[model samples]
Target: MRPTILRNIAASVGLLILIAVGYVCFWPVPVEPVSWQAFVPPGYVGPHAANTRLSNINLIEIGDEFGPEHIAIGKDGRLYAAMTSGDILSMDLDGTDQTIFANTGGRVLGFDFDASGRMIAADAMKGLLAIDPDGKVTVLADRVSADDPISYANSVVVTLNGMVYFTQSSTRFDPRKWGGTLDAGILDIIEQSATGRVLAYDPATGNTEVVARGFSFANGLALGSDQQNLFVNETGRYRIWRVDASARNIDVQASSSQARVLLDNVPGYPDNLLRGFDGRIWVGLFRPRNPAADSLSEWPFLRKILLRLPRSLLPTGKPYGHVFAINEDGDVLDDLQDPSGLYPETTGATETADRLFIHSLHARRIGWVPY
Candidate 1:
């Protein structure tokens, strides 16, 4: 009787193991991961060498608000920050006189001021929005057609000629339905669908048209000093692209003189691109590359299996804070890093004559360091 009972217990444990294996192997996941070779991460070396330069940043408290994702100095000489609560807050450079400028009722990832001083916002859930000086909000473009709507509007740049260019991050995973911006982005990147796009909106005719497509996750937009070239961040693939501003409906994947990768195989996941002082474009490395993710990149089935695990087991961005400035030639000019990662997600920096205001995705206060 004792022998029989021990055998039954062993059998039960074996059955449980089989069930777990089957679930991990066959369970459906949202991402249909594509097989691609991930470049071996260039560890902190050369221009991107490790440093403690960003360790001593000062904070600009925003009271109860958090996640000051994108910031810009408005034409009125005040700093405008788009918070996670959908409130656009205006404050003095010293973090004083903070006031709610406008609320778009959607998560705004990036925004820029137009020639008319209206804030053009790339709201992740609400599409392209324009907020007037008096705080009236308007939806400029939400859909390309009745059937195709903009899923993730991100990073906007208003040219001097009144053309508003913005990035639509992923067509497959909507942030609203898939938790939020960061989660949706993870799904899209893991899937490698390259559904991201660049679009142009003409306020004159209320018409929006596609500029370029075929980015894994098209983020961050900045116009060249000539106003003829647009610098775009393709986040998932760890690169930046320089696309001709006039190129219409161009596929970045196909060989085209219209779009070319300017920076390739950077050490980390690049986020926003801000054109800063003296022809330097500032870029933030949101997270360092995960070797496990890279190793699975060429194995689509394994990637799917990996996603079947618990959400907590999935690889996420580390807290390491890093941001850098680059020239048009793709040379790293300044690299600031906080290995301790005390400042959270440093998206990029807004450079004034004297300070570099660091942006973050989850920090309660805006960080700054002397320029």
Candidate 2:
């Protein structure tokens, strides 16, 4: 009996030794480098002309009124905004007629208008929803699969056939878990896993499919005006990718996919991407470049510590507040910033025929511009 017990113990000890040896030999990912280095790794870009303008703009404080996330403009010149705090709002360009458009009591992240002028929103807690003029809300689709659970539904773009394209920001983390605390370099590393994906929803058929995957941090989706392709903002990798939506072959191996790097490096990390009314692509940028951000996230031990820290205690990127307008190719075209410390930190943006609207999650106000 004693010999039998010793034999079992010996086998367990052997298995433990093998596992330790295997881990040491097989598990070696590159450690986090030294700083927010460049656009690619520890990838930090050198500063260029700040194409950002803090002026041609003014802020609209919605402090206690609403917590706006993304904006959509209607043909009637009314600005529709998704309130992440559980409501939808419509504001006149003048900022006078602010009213509750819908009360879903859920966080609406990205929003767009369809051909029938219905509001299509990507709600974080709820999946995709359609909002009517009377503020009525209907659930279009809800994702329950662990692979695509619509955690941080960041951006939405509607197609002519009533198809909706949007992003589920990150697979490793969600905004509610990492938003306020995503320090410089650590956030970029979380994105390196490239678990982010772009998804499409067809209301006519209630079908949703993963269109594009392997994005560093997929956030925005926009269909080119010519409808030839769609551009997506891979924020973590600091670039935008265009994919073929109308491709014919779909044998998985024969699936048609085309991707181009419109913009590769930037002074600050880019967020949402929307087709501006004035023939340009407007991008929301968060956190300017910093080297320390790299060292803070490079090592696995340090990264685990950083991710566990209370998000509020984490460091925020410099140039804490601003918005940017770039071309579809990712070239900086216009800068919208507030030099003063008035507006909230900007998150998402949308444009109407006459005005450009920007929303911030941590700030008390949204900003607008006369195009």
Query: Per-residue lDDT of 1-371 in model 1, one digit per residue for the tens?
Result: 69999999999999999999999999888989988888998889999999999999999889999999998999999999999999999999888999999999999999999988999999999999999999999999999878889989999999999999999999999999999999899899989989999999999999888999999999999899988989999999999999999999999989999999999999888889998998999998888888888888888898788788887776665789999999988899999999999999888889999999999989999999999
TM-score of each: 0.98, 0.77
Extract clashing residue pairs from model 1: none
Please give the TM-score that candidate 2 achieves against the real structure.
0.77
Question: What residue runs in model 1 are displaced by over 4 Å at the alpha carbon?
Answer: none
Candidate closest to the true structure, highest lDDT:
1
Model 1, 225: alpha-carbon shift in Å? 0.7
RMSD of each: 1.1, 8.6
The best candidate by TM-score is 1
